[model samples]
Target: MDARVDDKVVLVTGASRGIGEAVAAEFLASGARGVVITSRKANNVEAAAERLGEPDRVLALAARSDSVDDAD
Candidate 1:
């Protein structure tokens, strides 16, 4: 659980809900400078970012996890 994430940017894919959302929240709790959360739908990711409660530190991205282009 020691992430060493202080002031670091973390990316969490499939983060619209469930474990992915939890992991992203953990990164935020661990003092990550920012969390970039990705989901296939913009609305879902945006909602998740809002629920995380740190607008300045969270970015919602719509992406297909299976897509290499999206990964880029």
Candidate 2:
């Protein structure tokens, strides 16, 4: 898997689990610069980021699909 996704910044909504979480991990493995993972619960998001083993490379945000603000 030689994808050239290095230095890319990605924002992954609903990334606390399932498909979104998989996508985030893929991007990180591809050498993405940063990944902002958001979910409805802060703990869930933090947990997801921790799973990636690079907390410094992830920004865990508490958010829901109904919200309309870029918590960045």
Candidate 3:
């Protein structure tokens, strides 16, 4: 672990699982101030967030990357 993210906010897309989830976890492990995870499936991202096990430090949002509305 390093101070690379000491107090920085991180946004990880497609984070419901796979590489995105791993990245989000790493950010937390590396000491990020907070992490915002997004995915097309609401349930999936929410579960992924919970799995990260840092409720206070993680925010999960269901958003389709290709959707203009979701982007907003």
Candidate 4:
């Protein structure tokens, strides 16, 4: 597949697991320049980012998906 997201930035919620994680991975594979991943727990987000193995390209943030304040 082509790197459609080349040089683009992506934000992914609930990225600790499931479909969100998959989307994040796909974005990276498609050549995103940066990816921000969020989850309710800091530890889970950190772990997921670590597992993604692209420290310079990935950022992990803790935020509740149901809360608007957290999203800000």
Among all candidates shown, the one with the greatest TM-score: 1
**Judged by lDDT, which candidate is best?**
1
Report the lDDT tens digits of candidate 4 across residue range 25-66. 899999999999999999999999998999999999998776
> What are the per-residue Cα lDDT tens digits for candidate 3 across 1-72?
454997999999999999999999999999999999999999999999999999999999998775467556
By summed lDDT, the worst window of 10 consecutive residues in model 4 runs over 63-72
lDDT of 2 by residue, 1-72 (tens): 376779988898999999999989999999999999999999998999899788878898997766667884
Model 3, stretches more than 4 Å misplaced? Answer: 1-3, 67-72
Question: lDDT value for candidate 3?
Answer: 0.93
The segments of candidate 1 whose C-alpha lies over 4 angstroms from its true place after superposition are: 67-72
Poorly placed runs, candidate 2 (over 4 Å): 1-4, 66-72
Task: Indicate whether candidate 2 or candidate 3 has the larger TM-score.
Answer: 3
Error of 2 at 34 (Å): 0.7
lDDT score at residue 12, model 2, on the 0-100 scale? 89
On a 0 to 100 scale, what is the lDDT of residue 34 in model 4? 95
lDDT ranking, high to low: 1, 3, 4, 2
**TM-score, cand. 4:** 0.84
User: Residue 18, candidate 1: how far off, in angstroms?
Assistant: 0.4
